[model samples]
Structure formats: structure tokens, C-alpha cells
Target: MKVKSVIVPSGMEHLTKFTRKIPSDVNVVPVTNDDSFSNIPLKILHPSKKGRGKNEDSMVLYGQFGLKSFIFMGDLDRRGERQVLQDYPSLKVNIVKLGHHGSRTSSDPNFIKQLEPELAIISAGRHNRYGHPNQETLNTLKMENIS
Candidate 1:
């Protein structure tokens, strides 16, 4: 199967190491603003605007099997999501992996409204250090009727 990943510059080190554990048969596509991995088929979703110093822009990856798409926000903030919405006005997706584990720093009301993804996944270690998936973020998702 083909696998696509969006890696913000700051997360590359960890992601790179993690990727090594995956099977070689999978085709991995990493999207990022870092030129260091330029030779590795990086897709730049936002080029003009400066994203979170480490290139924090909202990225969309189309699934190889179907028309479904997944949007990955590597610690992207509200502003970044807005920029993405503007960049792709007609953007739609099947799933959205919430940025920063649904931290209050991200997930703007309008951004969530626009995305309206069928499923929202927040990748966070259960009851770790930071209190992620903050109440406000959950409320926001509930307000938008997103599960």
C-alpha cells in the first residue's frame, strides 16, 4: 500500500526515525517545506507564506486507492489553517488529524467549520504530560458536530 505523510520541519527528525520502522514495500511520500528532503519528493502546500518558523502549513494528501484525502497539520495553528483554507478554497477531506493533539493553540472555529471532515483523529499519548485535547477544543468539535 502507498503511504503519504506530511512532516513539518520541526517534526522531521522524529518522523524520519519512526519511518525507518515501517515496511519497505510501502511507498512513503512526505510533504514538507524543508529543502533538506527536497530530493525525496516533498510537496509544498504553502510556499509564499512563512509557516511556524519550521514551515507549519496545512497539508493535504490524497489517498492512492480512492478520492478520499487526509489533512495533516503538524502543529499548525489557526492562522496556518486559515491560510490553507484560502489556498485551497474548495478543499474537502475524509479525515483530519488535528494539529498538536487538539491543543487550544490550534483549531480555529472557522477552520473547523470549513474542513468539516467526516472523521477527526487526534494523535496524543493517553494522559501524558501536556493536557492535550483540551476541553475547549472538544467543545469546538462538538459545536461543529464533528465526532
Candidate 2:
């Protein structure tokens, strides 16, 4: 199936944000809390801030199909996670892609508890400088028993 639309953060251009092929007629829209994709049954959520910068505004993506649900967090920090928790109190998914590669600045314990996912994945680089997948985050995951 063709990609009908791509929802990105407000004011973000296609060229800088992506490397894939996007057809001219496909709708490229901004990410908003209220909007969601129909074809893939995915809902995109972003921080309150509109401007793009070093600030963490990771767009949390929730993809649900049939009985399985997945939450993919893109470099989201603690604040952004808090915003998500506040916005969606019932925001629990089966699988979660950890934020900021499990950096100390992300993956708050409360947030983990809320999610209560069966499996958690961290997209961390091998021996990266940032010390991704921090020990604290791992400990939190272990404490929560999120495999």
C-alpha cells in the first residue's frame, strides 16, 4: 500500500527530516495530539513546544493493530514523557521503544510503571559516547520487570 500521509513536527521540512521517497501528492502534515493515521492505526504525539531545537520534543508514536500495541518514543526526555503521561493517563502499550537510548535524562520510573509493557527495546548504538542505555534506566526496567 502507498504511504498516504507523513505526520511530522510543525514547521519541519521533508528534506531535512527524512531520506525516504515521498510522492508529491502524499499529504505531509504536522504532528498534533488530536490527529492520527488511519491506514496503519498509528497515533502521533509530541511535546507542547512547537519550535525545533536541542530541546527534547520526541514524537511518541503509538501503533496498534489487532491485539498488539507498540509505543515508539523518539529521543524523548523526562519532561516530554511527563507531558505524554499527563496528556494520556491511560497510555499503556504492549511494546515500547525507549527514549534517548535509555539515557539518564529519560525513561522515568513513573513513566515505565504507567506503560507496563511486556517488552521494551532500546535503540542504542554500540559503545556510543553518550553512554546510552544508562545503568539507571536498565535498573528501572529491571525493577519494573519490563523485559
Highest lDDT: which candidate?
Answer: 2
Query: Candidate 1: which stretches are off by over 4 Å?
Result: 1-43, 47-67
Give candidates' CA RMSD values in order: 6.5, 3.3
Which ranges in model 2 have alpha carbons more than 4 Å from their true place?
1-6, 14-28, 53-55
lDDT of 2 by residue, 56-81 (tens): 75577888778989998888889889
Inter-residue clash pairs, candidate 1: none
- Give per-residue lDDT, candidate 1, residue 82: 80
For each candidate, the alpha-carbon lDDT, in order, equals 0.65, 0.79
lDDT score of residue 116 within candidate 2:
91
CA lDDT, candidate 2, residue 92:
90
lDDT tens string, model 1, 12-90?
Answer: 3345565687666655443344333534432454433333344354443323125667777767777777877787788
Q: Record all residue pairs in model 2 with backbone atoms less than 3 Å apart, i.e. clashing.
A: none
TM-scores, each model vs. reference: 0.64, 0.80
User: Number of the top candidate by TM-score?
Assistant: 2
